[model samples]
Target: MKRWRHLALLLMLMTLALLALPAYLERAELQLWLLGPAWCG
Candidate 1:
């Protein structure tokens, strides 16, 4: 039972990370966009 609970928690965390990834990537892209010109030149 304890092992099952741990597995469930791990699965939930993985799911949450997958869901959050796109938003994280969008924020990263926005940051790059904001700084892109300065870096490029």
Candidate 2:
């Protein structure tokens, strides 16, 4: 029972992180796009 609970918590966290990854990548991409040229020049 305790192990099951821990597994469920781990699964939930993994799901949340998977869901958030795209948005995090998108934000990073946008930041790079917005700032890339300035840095390059």
Alpha-carbon local distance difference test for all models: 0.98, 0.99
Off by over 4 Å in 1: 32-41
For candidate 2, lDDT tens digit of each residue in 1-41?
99999999999999999999999999999999999999999
Worst 10 residues of 2 by lDDT: 32-41
**Cα shift from native, residue 1, model 2 (Å):** 1.0
Candidate 2, number of clashes:
0
Q: State every prediction's TM-score relative to the real structure.
A: 0.64, 0.62
TM-score of model number 1: 0.64
Q: Best candidate, lDDT-wise? A: 2
Q: How well is each residue in 1-41 modelled by candidate 1, as lDDT tens digits?
A: 99999999999999999999999999999999999999998
